[model samples]
Target: MQHKTIADTMNLTIDFNDIDDGQFADVIEKIRAERRALLKATQEKYAKSRAQKALIEQQKQRLRVQLQCLYGAVVLIMLSLGWVFSNLEGTTPSLDEPGITHRTIEMTRDHRLDGIQLSQVERYFTAKFLVGDWRFRGANVEGNGITIHIEMPQPLSLEPHYQREYIRNSLCPKGDSELWLSVEPANLTIHLYSDHPSRGQSALCAS
Candidate 1:
């Protein structure tokens, strides 16, 4: 009876050992699930870091584009100012014939004189007088050459009457009519004259 009892106890111990193996399998499965969760968390962290890096790179690219635009604008402004200054420097006046010639003559107006002596430059001798900025009543040929009758806006004594003419030609140089009047008035009278009309002296003026 003692030997039978010993055998039964040994069989019961083997059965318990088999049940413990199944419990160990469940623990191993749980451990595997935890490892998978850890791996997913790590992957998510790496993805977030990569996204941040890409965003930072995009910002840098935008800043670079803006900087390039500002540099281009500065260069363009500098070039434009240089061009304007160069043009201004080239327009300075120099010593040359008809560079800007002004000749004023004195004339005593009298009815016995019958004509006013008009002086002209060689370039304007045969040229038609385009009534530029000169204030004049009438112009015609008198005794010697072309005559320009000047009229003042206010009745002022004759310091001297000036006859003005501007010659227009293809090779005509650029000039301002500033020499004609010191101060510009509201109303002015002007007349056109050409010496080719009368070869001989007329009752007006000689050319």
Candidate 2:
């Protein structure tokens, strides 16, 4: 069967042979008017559908932007939390040691002295005690540095045993007696251990 417009259907249903020429023309014009109305209705429907699709697309784009911003903020918060926890975990608290303690050299590798010679150091002590007419000799230098073996003319309080500590503890380089000294006495001979060398002519101890 062939497709027919409203004009063709109406012409087939009406008895045009019985109608006058003027009436036939009037019926044809009425069919043409219906065709124009149908075309306009179809165009209006298409325009409404196109506008709906554009509105939907705009809404979808706004939703995508909102999701992107939410994701970025969540990522930033996670990074900030990680950094705070890491710093908290790595931190340590400190405690103090009790007493009025002096600083000590724990590592002896660099204990060797370059500022002064052992011979020059000996002369400093020898000349210092000459007022007491106490004789001084270099005798020997201990294995490394910071110690010397000396012989005096008298016992100089070299009593039996531990009493030597009292004398040594009280000793220091001449002008700076607050500096530490230790003595090992055997008769008139004493082994003086210090942070060694001295002030004045010797550059070891402070002035």
Candidate 3:
């Protein structure tokens, strides 16, 4: 008859009624083998788990680095675009008013602008300073004279002498002959005429 009892590591059947001293050694050996096998399995399983955890951590770290790089690249691109747009915006105004701007006036002061440009500048100044809807017809360069032809609307609003002073002082450049503001009553057109005479004309006195 055999009896069943719990051993150290595993279940084994042995005779308890008549104890076999010879078989006891075999049972002990079997239990020792079972413990050794269990230990090896546990150690292998723990080592595999640790390796898996380390690999997962490494993967997570690499993913974090990749995300950071991508974010940095996007920010850099945005900054570059902002700088480019800012410069482009700085170059020109977004809106233009009817009259000449301060920037245009500054351009006229520069001597580099040619004669034709200066005539145009005169038209701009005329529109800005004096009242009325004055249309610039064209500018003429005669022998020593320069005439700015303009179409004025209706009976002269401002004093004719006021226009003459403006033409002599502001419109005319160096070596001017204030030929005067001549008007064609039939067409409501006016001419701001000036000339570089044989004898040089004096500049207007500063007020």
Candidate 4:
């Protein structure tokens, strides 16, 4: 007898009442085999999809680490540049306009004279001021001391102020003894007498 088989997309329904036992067994085995093959194919496809997802996640993690490193390097470079600029700002001087320049000439204990002499002080001031392209205009030797004038190619702004203190400290190394110092600005001149009795007396006794 012939069996009626209802075929669907993924399964077959057999009416066993009209079929022989041996044919029915054969059809059942064929269906079981098809089911096993389909299940195996489905498992392989799922495993491949899982592997692809894992590879994509790994790539994303690597990219994230690289971006973090790049950002850190950029920040470090910016900090370095800021430090360099701050240092430059401190050292660099403003040159908006020409400023006054001045210097003080004084004698230490090692270079003290018994009596203050204008000519000798003038020579000392001249020698000190006539360095590094500085033109010595002239010296005015008065009863108190001498005032030496100087000329420069450019108007002084920063260096002279610092040099004034440095020169004072260097010339008056021996703080105990009295010393005569002449302060002459680029535009004005002043005579200063030492506080020591000997030098003060000599200045007062000068004709």
Candidate 5:
């Protein structure tokens, strides 16, 4: 019984050796096609994974660029605001300090006065009065005279008599021209009248 079983097993093993060439060729082609299909699928999967990673990296780079731009813009805006506030602080005077009163006065220059005379008059006031919180308010030119307004803070007082003498000695010197100065404390108005034979012009006074 053992010898018969061995003979049957040998026959089954040798049966594959009798396969025809056409059948073997077909089997080999089928296996090659399956392997090609599997290789193609693996290649496609790897390519897709790589593309997704590239897209994700691109998105991260774009986000980083946008964040950098936003930070730079924020810094520029902050610097601009700081500059504006600093300029405002420097130009605007504080009102909390005592004896800091706002006052306005007008100084008129006769059109007949030459540039030298005009400069002298300007220099005299700028040197003596335009100091210690005193500032030029504004100026206007009308008709034959130029009017200038000035503001003085607390502790700075413009005495009319002293200013008259100073102007006469400093500006008119040897000339027969007279400098008339009048002050109205209630209205904060100062009228400057220049009486010269060459120029008989009037300075319109307003506060």
Candidate 6:
């Protein structure tokens, strides 16, 4: 009876509970592995996208800087051009005034000497004076036995040579004539009555 009971119990039930447990464990492991792989792939994609975005932002910043630099350069150039044009416009002369001017001269002689020879007088004048618009308005001179008065158009001042070559050349030659002047800023009315006809023929004064 005991042997029979054992056989019957063994044969009575063959439960599939163990197989169910093994199958459940395998499914859980597979799900976990898939989750890990998916997470890794997502991380890689996110990192790549972040790097690309950073590069694009850097390029944008560089372009912005270049554009700003170009704009600044253009502004500076325009300012320089404007200044040049303004100076050029201001330097031109007007048309209302005359181009040339002239003057007259008066002469005198000493009274203490009588019967003065017409050729016995000898004199010289020297000056470095500022120039004016009219002749005697700005000039300087000194000498014995002669007096002079004259009107002029330019100042007695010396003009710049290299810069104003055309104007400097236009003035009468100096240093060669005995009665010449380095123009100044004054008007002296005097007499110049020379007894010497030979001296009268020479250059008495110039502007």
**Candidate 2 on 62-144: residue-level lDDT in tens?**
99999999999999999999878534432111122111012212211222231123334445566666676443434223233
Best by lDDT: 3
What tens-digit string does per-residue lDDT give for candidate 1 at 139-195? 333233333333223332322222222212211222453312321221122233232
Q: Mind giving the per-residue lDDT tens digits that candidate 4 earns over 1-207? A: 443332342465545686677787877776677678878999999999999999999999999999999999999999999878634432121122122122222221112231133334445555665677654444443323434334455443435444444334433213342223332211123222222212211111111
RMSD of each predicted structure: 20.8, 22.9, 16.5, 18.5, 17.0, 23.9
Error of 6 at 183 (Å): 17
lDDT of 6 by residue, 116-170 (tens): 2111111121132134432321121222322232234433343333313432243
How many steric clashes does model 4 contain? 0
lDDT, each prediction = 0.37, 0.45, 0.46, 0.44, 0.43, 0.37
The collision pairs in model 1 are 141-205, 142-204, 142-205, 142-206, 143-205, 143-206, 144-206, 144-207, 145-206, 145-207
In candidate 6, which residue ranges exceed 4 Å CA deviation? Answer: 1-24, 91-207
lDDT digits (tens) for residues 1-207 of candidate 3: 343323422444444456577877766676677678778999999999999999999999999999999999999999999888644432221123222345443442332222333344345445653765655544332222333444445433446577656555654432332222221111111253222122212223221
The segments of candidate 2 whose C-alpha lies over 4 angstroms from its true place after superposition are 1-15, 91-207
How would you encode candidate 5's per-residue C-alpha lDDT over 27-127 as one tens digit per residue? 45655666677789999999999999999999999999999999999999999998886344322222332222242111222222322233333444456
In candidate 3, which residue pairs get closer than 3 Å at backbone N, Cα or C atoms, i.e. clash?
none
lDDT for model 2, please.
0.45
TM-score of each: 0.34, 0.37, 0.38, 0.39, 0.37, 0.33
Ranking by lDDT: 3, 2, 4, 5, 1, 6
Q: Candidate 3, residue 133: CA error in Å?
A: 46
1 versus 3: better lDDT goes to: 3
Candidate 4 wrongly placed segments (more than 4 Å)? 1-12, 91-207
Per-residue lDDT of 54 in model 3: 100
Q: Output the better candidate (5/6) by TM-score.
A: 5
lDDT of 1 at 72: 100
